[model samples]
Target: MGKTAPPSIVVVGSGLAGFGVLRELRRLSPDAKLTMVTLENGHFYSKPALSTALAKGNTSETLVTSSAEKMIAQLKLDARIGREAESIDRAGKALCTTGGPIPYDRLILAMGAAAYRPAIEGDAAHRAISVNQLDHYAYFREQLPDQARVLIMGSGLVGTEFANDLITNHYQVVVVDILTLPLAQLVPPAVGESVRDALASEGVEWHLDRKVVAINYVGDRAGYVATLDDGSNIEADLVLSAVGLRPNVALAQEAGIDIGIGIKVNQYGQTSDPDVYAIGDCAEYQHGISAYVTPIMAAARGIAQSALGTPTEIRFPPLAVQVKTTLLPVNLLPPARNCVGEWHSVESDVDGDKHLFIDDRGFVRGYVLTRQKTEQRVEMDTKVGELA
Candidate 1:
């Protein structure tokens, strides 16, 4: 008898999810032939810092922690960088790329999400810069002119963060949104209002409950004219589109894989086809799912276990959504689900304020604490642990 042939796995989209899968799978089977395909140059870095770059006085070139060559050497796997995965040949177990078709025993779609650019009448505004990826940010940085007038669309977390950073960088920044308040859908009205107020105090102008109807390119290099829904207009040197994101699922959908908000997957990160899996921003979870970092880590752990032949079962635990705004002087953590609680706030000179969501059972499900009160984190954790 002879030894069986080793399985080959192909992972598409080399973002956090793809990198996670590769790293986990390697631990599971060191001899497993793994290949990663990416649309960009397949560099690796922490994306969380993208929001605070300008404020930190960091350039896009300096932000990139590692390049494709470094990642390839570190991961020690076959990598196809700077090439797009056109589609998948499931019947043949291959990924069609710009370079060529590569065979795989298992496929992982981690291409991540694309910025949702809405249909608005505009020449250059609609085609404005977006900071979703390092590449896009790099391009925006390179093309930025001296003392640019920046207009940003959308007032969600990313939108506000970028606005704050741009203001810190001495750019004339204006944020426009159709919502009555910023971070409207994420946090409660009161909390969201506070965030908007804080950002406004930092010199970020807001056009709440308004929309950009059209955009016009000004004289040769005179910037842009942004038309508003109220028949008003503003001129700017550049515009940033920070609307939202839609997962990259065309590849999986083309391969006849399940598609929901994103590529459908289970706790094990397994798709409809067991041999295929998806993760990260591109993964569509089911039943009161939270698309945050904690669940993604759990998905990676469970998927790796299965890939290693242990076939472990893992369920995502209730994790708080922590909003990192260093200027906020508080760590804003969202209230957990199934928590019928009262939201109360306690203020201290040491800690700006401690906001707690206490359940009927006298347990703290979640909390938002200011940096001044971060020392009280132990007490909050104890309360949450009781509920757990």
Candidate 2:
């Protein structure tokens, strides 16, 4: 009798996570039946590059490294681009996508995440944009005028980076956040103040500790007047909502897969169903939702091994995320959720800043570096203990 063919693997995204799993899977099993489905055109590009592209004089088209055809040929997999996965039919072992139903012996959900848009009353609220994908970035670029005034909601990593990039690119930028300081969730007060001051020096305006109550259209102008909770208003040509991202887990949830902050997956990225798995921003493991690239890559490896029958458990190291703010470069290894620790700034002679999050037992749980101090990322990464 002839040998039985391996079961087909259907991957439900073409983002970094999806490609990461595909690469690792191919490396392990040469003839694995693989297929990739995505709502995008399936062009591979660095998503982090989107925020900083304008400052470097790069356009959306310049960011794409490979098209669907190129990736399909290079990876030797069936490609389904510009198609949405409507739902997962667990019983039928198939994905119901816009194009058609795709049967799979194994399934991987790498559906990344969606930009969060907060509820605010006003006529122009629907006009507020959030650039989470290449197409969205392209639209944002098209909407921007020369020397435009931009109002950004949320002062987190994406908001701050966009502020720096816009300011550097000759745009008038204003950032508003409910938090007291920029990157309030990630960095210490001192570091956040440093970032705020640095960006302020570069012509970026900050309106912290307030939320947008309304976004009204300016009188006969293609602009908006954002009314804040403090009864203040800011006039701008465009508004960007960078509040954050929520994992795309509706499909998994509908399929009866467990979900926490994201789709709950085991150490090997397996969901409630052993044959189905998840990775990247859409997945939540033991620690939490590891939305960053380093952790996603780490999980992808284990998921690939598990899908290929090796069943390798994911062990994530201290993954430090680099914030692409040119004004005040930052590298941070955030502490675990609800971790009982306090940040203490390390005295530095270099023209930069460093801080460590030490727990009750005096163990270094997390670390942050800014400007020249970011050079210590490698050393600090090696010294920090495993993340959860």
Candidate 3:
């Protein structure tokens, strides 16, 4: 009898999640038949680092840790770069892409989310750029004028980070958000205010409890006029949208896969189709979406191992999400949405603050560390009431 060929694996997307699984697979199985399909050129860069890098005078080119060719050679995997995975044909065990169909014994979908482009009224609303990838950030950097005035939408993690970087780089910045506090979803109100004041000291104009309702071009030089929901106008040379992300689930949904906030995945990273798995921003896991670094890595490990013949359970500790605003760094482990909790300050100083969320049951549900206090991460994680 002829020697049977090794099982073929196809990974859709080249974001952190895709890379995580790729690395795990390579580590576990040498000479594995692996193919990666991606929408963009698969150069590897820290997507999270982009917001903080501008202040250090780093460009997109410098931010990329490795080129696509370098990564491919390093991992010994074939890549179909600049191609979009259009659909999945489970019965045929193939992935249909813009280029063509590729057969796969196992498929991994890590099609990360697109930055949410909120609808605004006016001609230049379409020009509000959002950076969700290296390419997007590159374009944004190239489009800005020297020391340009920037209008940033959303005071969340991305927005706050960019504001700090831009302000530090001496760019005039104005930030608008519907939320009352900066990092409202993550840090406590007082901590948010502290970071807000810190960034404001570096020249970030805040328009909280408001939204940019409209935007229009002022002149031929890419200047903009943003109209708030309250009918106030702010002028800037560039407008950046950092609202959030909506997972790219259309391809999976059309293929009859279960969908939630992201593609539904089990503890083993298996989707509704056991042969297919998902992770990163596109996966709606049992604990919620696996969008951040730690969960993505854990889920990818489980997926890679299980698909390679080991059925391992995916587990990760309670997240300590970092808000990369340099003026005042924040580490947050916020309480669950349904938890009846109150944030109480455990420690405070002029430059830093720490707060713990104690639930109605008198259990430590979550914690926040800001500025100088963020250094105590290891010491603080022990205070969690339960291991989530």
Candidate 4:
């Protein structure tokens, strides 16, 4: 009898989830032919660090914890870095890439999300940068000048964090958002107000409930003039578009795989094609698109097992999403999908505030903690219950 060939497994994307899956899969099935196709250099770095790197005075070199060469050798992977996965030939069981087609018995799509930049009219609008990756962060850092005036285009987690970081570094920071308050999507109005006040005290100029309609370069000042919808002009050296992220699903959609806000996946992270799986920010699970770190890390083992012939069911515990702004630390565990509830203040003190989401039946569905109160996340997690 001839020796049977080892199973071939290919992973797309080199972000946390992709790299994590490879680590687990290699441990579970040592002889499985593992290959990775990524658009990045495949280096390992902290995604959260991008927001505060400037405040901490950390460069790209310090941010990168591991090199591509080290990760490839450590995992024994055939890493095709800098190669884009153009499409997936589902029927052929191969991934078509810039480097060429690679056959696989199982494929994992962890392409992640792209930084979304909305259209703002002006010739210099293209000067705005969206820091979604390491190279983008590097370029942003390089362009920053001493006492630079920055116009931040959103007040979401990334935008606020960056604003805080820049302000801490003595840069003139201005944040413009259509939303009424900072972290409106993540916390209650009161919490958002508190954060707003904190950052404002640190000299962050907030232009809430407004949009930058246009931008034009001012060569004399070495800056750009951003005109708001209200006809107000703000001079800025740089503009950062941190509006949000749209999940990467074009390749999956082109392959005729299911896609919602992101690539749809089942309990085991299996896509429409049973042999193909997706995890991380690109994957839309039954709950929703989980872009946070904890849930992504928790899904890695189960996903790896299911991909390598096991039928392990994937389940997630109540997860907390923390906003990494040192100015006003926030920890939130959101309510279940479509759960009817309202945020009720638990305690408000000079140090911080604590609030909980109480459903109609009086069950604690979710909760929010800030500043000193954020230390009680474990206690809050235990209190997270759902509506009947």
In model 3, residue pairs whose N, Cα or C atoms come closer than 3 Å (at least 3 residues apart or on different chains), thus clashing, are none
Sort by TM-score, best first. Answer: 2, 4, 3, 1
For residues 205-302, what per-residue lDDT tens digits would candidate 2 score against the true structure?
99999999999997647589999999999999999999999999999999999999999998889999899999999998888988888888889889
Report the poorest 10 consecutive residues by lDDT, candidate 4: 379-388
Quote each prediction's TM-score.
Answer: 0.89, 0.97, 0.96, 0.97
Model 1: lowest-lDDT 10 consecutive positions: 324-333
How far is 97's C-alpha from truth in model 1 (Å)? 2.3
Candidate 3, 1-388: lDDT as tens digits? 9987777899998989899899999999886899999988999888888888887778999998999999999888889998989889999999999999999999999899988888789999999999999989899999888899999999988999999989998899999999998898887789888888999887899999999989999995658999998999999999999999999999989999999889998888899999998889988888786578877888888889988878888876676688888788888887777789799998888757889998898888888988778887767676662556
Best by lDDT: 2
- Greater TM-score among 1 and 3 belongs to 3
Minimal lDDT window, size 10, model 3 = 379-388
Predicted candidate 1, C-alpha RMSD: 2.7
What is the overall TM-score of model 4 with all chains considered together?
A: 0.97
| All models, RMSD in angstroms | 2.7, 1.4, 1.6, 1.5
Question: Over the stretch 225-248, how does candidate 1's per-residue lDDT look in tens digits?
Answer: 888899989888888988888888
How many pairs in model 4 have backbone atoms within 3 A of each other, for residues 3 or more apart or on separate chains, i.e. clashes?
A: 0
Candidate 2 clash pair list: none
lDDT of 4 at 47: 88
Q: What ranges in model 4 sit over 4 Å off?
A: 1-4, 220-222, 385-388
